[model samples]
Target: MDPMYQELKEIEHRPYPLQPSPWLMTQVWRDLLFMHYPVSTDIIKSYIPTELELDIFENKAWISMIPLRITNMRARGIPPVPYMNSYLELNVRTYVVYQGIPGIYFFSLDANHPLVVTGARTVTGLPYKHANMSFEKHEETFHYASQRIHTAKKLNVAYQPGHILFEPQEGSIDHWLLERYCMYSFRGGQILRGDIHHDKWKVNRAEAVISTNTLVPFIPGEFIGKPPLLHYSRRRRFFIYPLKEV
Candidate 1:
């Protein structure tokens, strides 16, 4: 048995990931466009951070938490830019919490701010580096930018702001622009993967087996590995389609 497995087996249970609420849906969407998008003479200045205050050139860091789900997946690889592996290798702290409904919302943190959310997905979580609104990937014109666009569409649909105001701050911003928009990536080393000291198990051993084997590759933890004799029941996966938005 693997030592990591032995240690995981010792633990009886783990905590569940936090879920997003209806209010959160309203807030995230409004921020992404009205807050993050850099446009001149914006009315929503109160919500937007100041450029002078943002040390975008200085490499000031912060965290952006994107509350959404993963829709597409691909092996970590490079595109037309060869000789480089393209993964969501941005140096930052990222957390994905199951919304308990359907999708998982991702929270990204860096030296810029504490918790600035950037984007979200509906059918699934964003592919590695796919959700980083600051990356050139987001700016690319021809590629399947569909992921983020789809996510943005979903957000627009979920948006239920009865009186939400979109504006930049009145005064010159004192924080990083990405911090305000939660759209940028970190500039330094990344956090360790195994260091994800989550104590709660999202699925039981039996269920994990079916998940790892059938759909995605199983990430070995402590105990549950071999396939179970019976299939575990699951809830209906919820999705907020972007194309359906008004």
Candidate 2:
């Protein structure tokens, strides 16, 4: 079987069955860093769209800043282009459940590639902005940075994955944060959802030094000042289906 098909065999961990439609594209997220913070539900309520409700974990709302390199990216029936296929991305997102299905809600997504940024914005309806970013690996530790264009928001983080890796329990916070299979966005005065499928995430304890992170300005600096809950996954291959009205 093809490796992409192999990723679908472990669907028992999925919250719902895969979409009957064929996936539209594939990408691999490498050196991914997930920095999560708990925030007041009241603070997040206003940012959320009226049609959607916040997906709370442990009675508190959560948000995450993820910095990753997207590789092996190409649409169905096309081959991956050498330079265009890979780029760095930093996204600020929170969780939401719409019509009983859990999904991600993005506040912003910054990428280093202009074409990819524009294409994602037009194609997926998700927020994708251009930024200057870089990634450097030193043995087990990695240094990643990004500065968004036309805005003062930026991120600088150094993280390393731990030796032991394991699957997050079904109801654990880790599962709640990483197991989401779809994302919701508002475009053209309507709600849009895109189905996402990937193999089980085998994560390890992660430690990060967030020297500076102003990705979500409305989020108080106090939350940024406090240490965040960290998790790391070296890589994960993702298949994203097309977006459509919910």
Candidate 3:
């Protein structure tokens, strides 16, 4: 069996929120990095919709900056579209709970693929922006950068993953952040959800040097002056279901 399909067969580690199979889309996430910063709970409350509650750990809310390469993207039973199959992406996201189910709420997603940006905005109502981006790996480190076309919000970072990769233990912060299976969006006064699924992340501690990070203009740059918690994963094959109102 294909490794991706083999992943789907092992579901004991997955949470209960997954929508049933016949998932509408699939993609491969490569060289993913997660940079997490802690923020005051009060600071995040105003941004989340009233329909959703902030999902905090300990007593602090978290914001994660994710940089990744997306590939082999295609709808169920469809071949990969030539110009749309691959792209570099940067995401600003936070955690939220909707109707007792914990999930992610993206502040904004910037990608280099024009078709993807337009399609995501139109179809999922996600805040997707087109950007000029570059990605390359030197030795063992990944040098990733992106600058949004509309607003020159740029992010440049170089990171390398440690050799010891392991699954995040349940109840650990890594599990809390990376194990989420659904994403929520607020548009036109309504909340929508897109459910996603993949196997548990096998990640290693990552070392990163961030040179520029004004990707989130709404938040002050000094807010993350302190180093963030970092984790790196080589790849994951993901399946996504349709977006529906919650």
Candidate 4:
């Protein structure tokens, strides 16, 4: 087999041993900024469902606030929908595992489009909220901002990619945070799992200055003061499967 094909196969099969049988939707995430902070395990545990086991790294739990642009979103075998396809999204999430399958559990997901938010809530049963968001590129830096409609949660930051595009090394903290394939959500006292397929992340060293951040109110005040580990990616295509009751 070709070397590249072998590498791709390994990424697909390893970590999580299964793939979603029939993918339900397709989308592209662009200009993503991943900002992660270490938080106390007890604080994170308190906010998540009891059914999920907190996934810790180096004896610590981490939460990420990711801001990205979504484009080319469409259902299977269909073209992108008009007026509902593209938008900005920011999510506060943590890692969790159920029955040995590791996945992401979101605390909150805010998007600019109401139809997209409603559709996601109805289909995936995840916590999706409406927000006003904007994105602009100036010379080198990307300016991003989001404000939730119902809450005081908001974020404003400026970031840009450094000069290199590198992949995370295996068995590293960056690898642990970026290389997850599945996600778990709670709905009506039940747990639902969804698997996402995408190419290996091509990450760039990122620099960000956060002007304002109140995205995760549940996190303790002290932990919020520490600077986050930052990384950026220009784009990635995603294949998202329907949520299956676990």
Candidate 5:
């Protein structure tokens, strides 16, 4: 087996089944900032579909806001498309489990590209919205900003990666937040899951300042105070599988 595959096989705390047979697409995520906050399980469960169970840690549910650069995206065995090859994406997500398999459930995804946004919504049955977004790096800090089209929702954050890079320890809250291997979507009264494969995440403690954050309205919260946990990753490649009904 290839060394990369060998390393992936050694990933700690992977609870889902391995990626099966052929993959649907591949992509790379870069300059990712993960900001997570704890919420009541009752609040989260009201938003998720009835078919899935909310996955929690110590009786608390969590939501994450991730702003990242997406690149090198393409179908399996195909070259990356011209304009759609790269874009900026910000996602708001929570955790869930279906039939004992843990996965992610996205509340909303905002992207700069219209085609990518439409394609993702159509194919994956997720709520992907078009946004005016920008990403830039100045000195050691990276800046990300996004505004949803035709809506007042907006997010602005500036962050820098810390010096120490390490993997989340097993059974820790960081591990629970970052190590999910599959994602769930609901459409037409059916549950769907898409598997994603990646090597264990190497993350750095992150420092961030939030200038404005109107994205909290999507969840059932009146306000989100300072995030409790923040982490950053330089880059990671992904092997993505097609969505399958559960």
Candidate 6:
């Protein structure tokens, strides 16, 4: 049997929290920037299996971004400040699970809060039954917001699509950078000097890809996790909104 094939098979059989050597970080980055892949990196930052304590993954890479959604427009109410209609801000948070270069991106859609309003349903042809709000990562969801926000005044928007770069000082990135990347920004950057134990390493690739395109980019109504769990619930859901055309 070939050595590479044997190793791949071994990794496939292993558990999620694969304790890769610290050196795995160096190798993975090199492979990414150089576009040389099919390399296994269990020694660096192995796949996170179960919910880990925050301390264990401190300074590790994470991402966070404001999700794309629209809020419902409220009807005008008779008020002291007359002739004014209220609008709820439809916004959400998204997380990006950084893979070597092209990371697997997952969207967290909240089912209870839907941007688009379908007519209330009736089970037995009577009045509305239980209300159902579901969020989805579907192509339709992408267009949903534009339609809802078309009448909304553009407040503040900042998102850049396409090849961008980040040069972390001693592998130390700014907290805002990681947050924009849709990951948790703790201590600024993930691969710090302590995390790397090296002088400099280049990241040739950094992407958030979906495992399958069957679903929408992100639906905001889904099960996040049980409450009272700090680290568990903080993670934002991710969805691939259509990339803006260059």
TM-score of each candidate structure, all chains considered together: 0.17, 0.95, 0.94, 0.92, 0.93, 0.19
Each model's lDDT: 0.20, 0.88, 0.86, 0.86, 0.87, 0.21
Residues 45-149, candidate 4: write the lDDT tens digits: 999999999999999898999999999888877767898789999989999999998889999899999988998999888899999999999999999999999
lDDT tens digits by residue: candidate 2, 100-189: 999999999999999999988988888899999999999888999899998888999888888899999888999999999999999888
Q: After superposition, how far is residue 178 of candidate 3 from its true place, in Å?
A: 1.0
Off by over 4 Å in 4: 1-13, 18-20, 218-226
Residue-level lDDT tens digits of model 5 in 47-123: 99989999999888989999999998888767788998999999999999999998999999999999999999999
User: Candidate 4 lDDT (Cα, whole model)?
Assistant: 0.86
Write down the RMSD of all candidates, one decimal each: 22.8, 1.6, 2.1, 3.5, 2.5, 21.3
lDDT-superior candidate, 5 or 6: 5
Q: Candidate 4: give the clashing pairs.
A: none
Order the candidates by lDDT, highest first — what do you get? 2, 5, 3, 4, 6, 1
Number of the candidate with higher lDDT, 3 or 5: 5
lDDT minimum window of 10 residues, candidate 1: 26-35
Q: Which stretch of 10 consecutive residues in model 4 shows the poorest summed lDDT?
A: 1-10
Instruction: Pull out the clashing pairs in model 3.
Output: none
Highest TM-score: which candidate?
2
Candidate 6 lDDT, tens digit per residue, 16-110? Answer: 32233311111111111010111112321333212212111234333222223322222222122222221112222222233321121222221
Deviating ranges (above 4 Å) for candidate 2: 1-4, 218-222
Q: Which window of 10 residues has the lowest lDDT sum in candidate 3?
A: 217-226
